[model samples]
Target chain A: MKMTKIVRTTADVFYPFCLVFGLYVVIHGHLTPGGGFQGGAVMATGAALLIVAHAYEDITGRIRKTAMKILEAIGLLTFLFAGLSGILFHRPFMANWMAQTGKLFGNTVAHGPNPGDLNTAGLLPLLNVGVGIEVLGGLTVILLYMLSGIKEEKKP
Target chain B: MTPFLLLQALILLGLIVTGALIIAFKDLLAAAIAFAAFSLLLSIEFYILQAPDVAIAEAGIGAGLTTAIFLIAIRGTKRFEEKE
Candidate 1:
């Protein structure tokens, strides 16, 4: 059953905020209190908000299970490749070779009592993004699967 | 006690109340809402204790997603518990 118009509208209004805040947490994982899992859960909560606001048939079209599965695979691959990159750099697996390399997310960080820089986290932000996407896809897929199971049960 | 401590105590009281309410309510939907409230209060407690990471996780997964999932389950099954 679909929820009232007020719930649907409120979810629509808040969804973007959830996405943006989740991304912020993922991007600033090294500097902030939250990391990939929390951010991804927040994003998935946005998806859940939409899922609960609409009926099963109406929501499945918008948040396809296949797409979420593919997204989960992509996220895992991204994290795997990021970890494997350390081997290419002649370092141990998951090494901080990217740190202070003056490259992507590789800037020198100042000592204590200074403002934190986004580029100072080396491979952390990349890892955060990977895990964030994976968790988002995984959790949302679980919700979708549950909803689909309900649909099947509702039939004869 | 200081004001901060007093506020914390109040939140702790609320947690106990909501936790009990979850078990007391025969309406599954009401119980689910109480569970969400319990989670929200727990997250606040975590925040007060200087664990923002856990706080965010609790707020997102426990309070938000769990409530949504529970509501979905209740919709699929039954809203009120059957007297055994």
Candidate 2:
């Protein structure tokens, strides 16, 4: 228990730094080896650290079960919506619609200074973000159920 | 060896060790902690494998959330005792 406290404190102190680094991983994922999912998970570690340090009561009050459930549902729906949008636009499912927009940092990234650059990859970044959100939300719900004290009844 | 590969190997080793401990340990609380470690290590392995999405899912749901649940469950149940 004493050891757990020490570990928890260290992790809590380390969380902010981890969050920043996780964002970097997500934003630069297209250029590097990481993406939204990886970064989001890393971000989740920050929450993990807090839970360990402060205990579940402290954390649960901040992140209500109702909100988490809503986020999970929304995330899944958003992902499906994106796919449907592609179909509605007369394109195949999961078509790169952002390619038509042809903008980066508010302007066209392709055919600009960094032509055919990794940053210019159409719709991939957005897709990555969506996937990340969905994964995070879904995982959170699963974890919540596991953490909640609802037990299975035994039969005589 | 690349840093990514090195991390990957370390995470995998941690995962295996924790998994073994979780199975071998009779104490439910210790086993829960070991399982949490297993989840954390698995997340790191996922990151090293260039699957950040999966890594995040594992870290949040597997390590962070699951550990909390285990702690609560432990509170609700009887602690493990040695067999006579």
Q: Tens digits of per-residue lDDT for model 2 on A3-44?
A: 376777797679887678767766666666577777766665
lDDT of 1 by residue, B4-78 (tens): 899899999999999999999999999998999999999999999999998988988998788878987997899
Model number 2 iRMSD = 4.3
Candidate achieving the largest TM-score: 1
Model 1 residue A36 lDDT score: 91
Instruction: Please give, for residues A103-147, the per-residue lDDT of candidate 1 as tens digits.
Output: 988888767876688887788888899999999999999999878
Name every residue pair that clashes in candidate 1.
none
Candidate 2 Cα lDDT to native: 0.68
DockQ of each: 0.70, 0.32
Worst 10 residues of 1 chain B by lDDT: B63-72
What C-alpha lDDT, on a 0 to 100 scale, does residue B67 get in candidate 2?
Answer: 74
**Backbone clash count, each prediction separately:** 0, 7
Task: Give me the candidate number with maximum DockQ.
Answer: 1
Q: What's the TM for model 2?
A: 0.63
